[model samples]
Target: MLQIRKILLRGAGLEDALVQFYSGANVLAGESDTGKSFLLECINFILGAEKLTLVDEAKPYTHLAVEFVNSNDETITLVRPTSGGKVAAYHVPIADISGSGQSIAPTRKGKSKGPDVTSVLLPFAGIKEARLRRNVEGETQRFTIRTIESLFLVDEVAVIDQQSPVTGKATFGDTAQKRALSYILTGVDDESVAAGEKNEIVKARLKAKLELVNEMLQPLNERFASPGELTVLTDDTELDTLIGSLTGELENLATTRDAIQERSQEATRNILKADSQLLGIRELLSRYRLLDERYTSDLDRLDFISEGSFYFDALQEVPCPVCDQIMAPGHSHGPDSTALPIRESAVAEAAKIHAHRTDLAAAIRDLEVRLGSVEGEKHTIDTELKSLNTELSRTLAPRLEFTTERLEQLVNRHTEREATRVERERWQELVKLQNDINSSLAESGTPKQIWAGIPPKELGEFCAEIQAVLSEWKWKGTPHVEFDEKTFDITVDGKPRQSHGKGVRAVLYAALVIGLLRYAAKNHRPHPGLIVIDSPLTSYKKKKNQTVKGENGQIDAGVEAAFWKSLAKTSKDIQVIVIENKEPPTEMAAEVHYQWFAGEEAKADERAGFIPTKSAPAN
Candidate 1:
């Protein structure tokens, strides 16, 4: 397995920024504009990309070096100048990569007579010298490391693209990509295929093909009113800016609407609570009124009794009717009879009733006061709710509607812009095709070739591997994945891969790369055994205009967790590097090598980015 061990960027006055990798999984995640993408680009450059994309931050770096372990477990370090030159290979670690070492030409046509980078690296992947047919006339080109680089290194732009994961935006490279995949899967190449017929017959055929390609290009060229319009369509920056602005406006409107709705809900709850309290108070008041009526009746009866007792007391001691004997007032007539109370007892009972009635009156008054307060509170709540509803319906809702409509219009415009881009790419492809045909006609002889396609069984197994990867990632429906040889791409549940949204496309593309690695390992095929992917989980990040959905039409909440878990369990034979803006699931922290480009140096230990904030002299 080929594993990247470390990378170092050195300059005369800048610190040597260092990044390390392991055999299983390595993740570099953090804020944007922190050199994640630039790091990937640097890796590509060291792996023989023709040009190194330089940013302002990288201006001070003069040389790039990569240290990796080849399949044979031999450590190799390659150092190349940022300004472009031959790559120096050291059969040692980066610390010892300086001074004289074997010099390898960066390209096949380099001025140096030394071996090229492709020839040196191909053997590291266990692949022998190979050639692929580049045209119908059997014109072949040497299979180089660049041919298979796309399978291992997927950048941000290609990850979310609608194009085939194995292919690039340039249609001219499609055939080479297909043939390279076939070579990897079937261990077959077009080296032994028969050459085409030569002389007049070949020339005539080439002429006809050239004519056909020009015929296809005419309409595409005329699709735009002017060449300048087509040129503008080539760049996506303007359209992206417009879409981003519109999405921001829509998000603001939605946020405002949500705030209003939440306030309105709170107000409604308050009103309901006040209404409940008001009802309780009214019930209490009714009971208090009944108690007050009883108090009044008791007081009147007590007063009547008191007056009658006084008259009785004044009548002096009269004999009991049954005994017919003189008896003292307030005394009993017999053993079973009790003494009757005079006016004093009646007055005491009236006093007790009056006290209770006074307390009851106070309680009733308190309840009435509370009832009025609750009613007022309810009224206030009702008024506030009405205002909130009006604001939502009149102000925020209408604004939201307008913003949504504008967003839709911008999205439609973006779609149109993308279509124009595709047409322009198609036109470029046709022109290249025409050139290829003309070149074929100009050649003295041309060869016809018949290259074998990937065996069906192998293709099926490859697809199954992809399905298993997706299943492990908790993909919705565990959709059936099939390799479509016609399009040289995979299909999910009979649907073309490109038919899905960008988020799905990004994930599916990652699955493709990982599946290739697993399949190669299982089947004992040739592979680089290292995959470097950028922004595979970008769709899952909470970004504007990004919506990650599953086949069931709902957002798959488990996908991110499952993705991290699955990668954490990757075999030791492969090395996977992922650069993202979001952190991995916390549970997998111990399983993978993780780094954070915090984007700011808040702490002494925290890394600011790939480019150090301070400069140091190169050793």
Candidate 2:
């Protein structure tokens, strides 16, 4: 049994009354206006109910308080002053389950610790960030408990002696209604993939940026702008080290160019000097050769002229000494003697001079010919040297320049790569940091502190379980429940309707409660502090038994009485307080006995004056 220590009532139109109450089901039976409901209202006031309704003529309660003992025998009293409203409740701590003060604040006491009332009330408020978001998204709806009470309460289920409002456009017979029940039964504070999506987006953006930077950093030919094609490559060594090799190559080219130019210049100068020397030698040699040819011809002519002179001057002459007998002269002499005395010194000197001149001319001619050959050879050498110099300048110089140009390009390209490397490193680091920051991102993109206490996955499972129970009822459509960080969404047949029919809504409402309890049980979670069901058997379908019977059958009760019985059976683990106008199910109410009497203390309705207890309906 759920233990109840005492009940305190003040200004409920009653001056004096009992100071305690019986636990379990406390049935208040009295006259219609004799504080029967006030007793129940008193329980709600201390229970943190926000909405309070009373007749204008009837008086209001000044104060209401209740005491409850826990399993550890510690007592706590929840009190609410009428002026402060039901939401404003104060607590009183006691030593034991009995009415005795002990601790100052029971909830704050360290002994027999439980969850903070804030955490407990956090779910109860249903004003969490998730719920608010859902409400804005138009999923289920936005509501506070106070507003919920204005629409439906246990009083509507206990309709007797009068008919009540069947349904309204925005009544409890809507998807929002079922969700309200879900919230009441189980508090689902948070459930939405907020941080997950944000993290992914951040990662994607980082990757894109890193790729773009890497591509631009690459060498000209291998570069790419497209993010898909760009790939970032990393190397341990820096480009600065490679500069030495290029410098070495440039040095070699410069050296070779200098050496070739020097050799070419030397060859040119040598050829020019040799030509001048040969030219002088050739001039002297030409003069000598001409002299030699003239000398030789003159000698030959002199020999031939001597022979002719002998023939003309000397005629058949023998010896001049024996010419005494013969009168003929051996040789006719014209003004000259045959045996004349010669000028010996003049002849000898002329002969020596002639020989010396002839020899000198021959030697000069030989030297001139040799000098001419040498000069021609020098010309050939000069031409070869000039051609070689031209070849070096035309072919090798351009090649050297080409090498220079290529080296410059290589240097420039490498310089670009170096700069790119530095910048790319920054981008790479940013990408890594972005990844880390995004990893710490929350599930719903909100701060973890706000929703960390909520088990969104479990709440989803609870909704699914409720959907399972609702499957039995044939609604206009299938009913579904969805809760996110913002709000809850309920659908019938996978589609949203403005509202649901009375009978369908009632099924949804029950399913919601069953789902919550089932979830808690399956997960072995703590559930509501208390549950009160008034007329749990009340339904809104058209009465089948009230209609005429068909040809072959009577009627099929849409809801089997066994379902409620099963419900009561399963709800045993929780503190379920039920009051039924009709008999409760056999499974749950089997052992519970209810005694009835028609006497002065019997509960009465407004029509009691017109109808007596014996004439009243069985209910």
Candidate 3:
């Protein structure tokens, strides 16, 4: 499913070398001193690793270049080492790669036409060809790859053999070199990226993440997450806690408010009591004023009578209407009262008595009026105070309590989401781990037949299948090569172990990767369709670690190899490229197109090692 059209290199084992490859399997082989490994480096270079390589004779300043063609007829050219006296790069038309009649001409600064090239022949190289598009004359055009495109390349043997300081078995596959492929996906420029850049990148990414987290929490702070996001029980508990804290303060406030209201009511009650007393005093005052007014009116009448009494001067008994007729004396009788000689003193005394009575009437009326007004004002004040007390006690006070409750509810909602997020994240992780374990078991030769009654998601059933597989294992005498689900452990025979020997471990690892891939594929997860392996097999480095070769272990390897062959055959969509000096299963090899690079054509660093490039065992 994957093909290598060609690879080109400069200044490695060879000053200038290029190789063309078509589909099938290709092998590069050479004796220890030849350029086999150097050619491999060249492949890595052309694919996209950008390290300025130490080439033939250690020409550290040498430039590098590469080219490739894809199945879609797209040609890619790459060149690099441009700076530091290396000035590199140039591109050509696709027609040139197609071997057509058209030729490419180099343009100066601004040009109308551009070239096309984007693929990487290998994954790690020092050259790059990045495609850039520009709008010229209102027309869309694409630029050529001025740098190498990264492709997959493996140099395990050379890596393990290196004695260099930086060559301690890499924790990661050639980092700077592998960056070519990463660039395509991440748009990162290799030259711009430094070893220390990851820390900064991660920090920046985290900063952005934190900002988003803050924003999300801000809205959820208002209890605004969706139904799935907001957990009811969790929310309620959180609400309860928040409410509890606020309720204490609210309760204290309630006490203060109640006391204030009580004082206000008592003031009103006192005012009412004072008003009642004042009302009585006011009634008395009103009667006094009325009596005073009446006294003035009666005094005016008495004054008129006294003036007439002085002018009369007739003898008494002149008009005795009820006594006798024509009686003439110094006395006058009127309205059944007898009057003697008119006297100023008597008139004055009568006026005084009349004024006294009138004054009493006026005072009584004034008191009555004052009392009426006091009663009305007291009634009004009582009503206003009642309204005030009712509003404070019932409306505003209750509203404050309601507001407190709502605030607590909101706080609780946010806390619930925080907890839910933690729980869901953990739950998802556990599920993923459990699934990974089950998947590993399945790939470790645990058969579907043993797990036939179990569904795919049933991890417990899968674990049972694992136990069953172990119990039925043909090579059960050793200790912990088999896995245990109960303890999340592994054992070989009767001995407990976490990992196994290289040969078995390699198979196990392969099983692990494969099983995971299968599980993902079945569950509709995304997976790449290609795998590249370099020096995939080696004789056991430790003799004591070897399992009996003639036993079921050998048989299992055969079956596993067969399984790979079948997978390769059936899953034509996937491509598997494995490099090894050891012979593969003949049956599997027969189904693959294979080639071997012999003589001076193996790795890219061979020529750079200063060995005579021409002095190799000729095929």
Best by lDDT: 1
lDDT of 3 by residue, 142-234 (tens): 212222111233344321221111112334323332222223323333332212224345445435544555554554445433565445444
- Model 1, 1-619: lDDT tens per residue? 5789998899997779898998888999877767888888888999888789776777778999999897688888889998888898888999876677888987777334458787787676577888787666566777777888889999887777666777666576477778788777876787875556656666676677777888887887687547676658356788789789878888888888888889999998898899888888888898889989988998888888766654554555667777777766545663223314646687788889889988898898889888888888888889899999999888888888888888788788878878877787778767766776666555564523223467667888889999999999998886699888776778988888777776778888899999998998787777788899998887543344753334322225698789999999998888999999878878796789999887754367877788876422110
| lDDT (Cα, tens digit) per residue for candidate 2, span 33-72 | 3333444455554444544454332234465556655434
Assess the local accuracy of residue 26 in candidate 1 as a C-alpha lDDT between 0 and 100: 90
For model 3, the local distance difference test gives 0.42
| Alpha-carbon local distance difference test for all models | 0.79, 0.45, 0.42
Off by over 4 Å in 1: 110-114, 199-451, 540-555, 614-619
Indicate the worst ten consecutive residues by lDDT in candidate 1. 546-555
Which ranking of candidates, highest lDDT first? 1, 2, 3
**C-alpha-based local distance difference test score of model 1:** 0.79
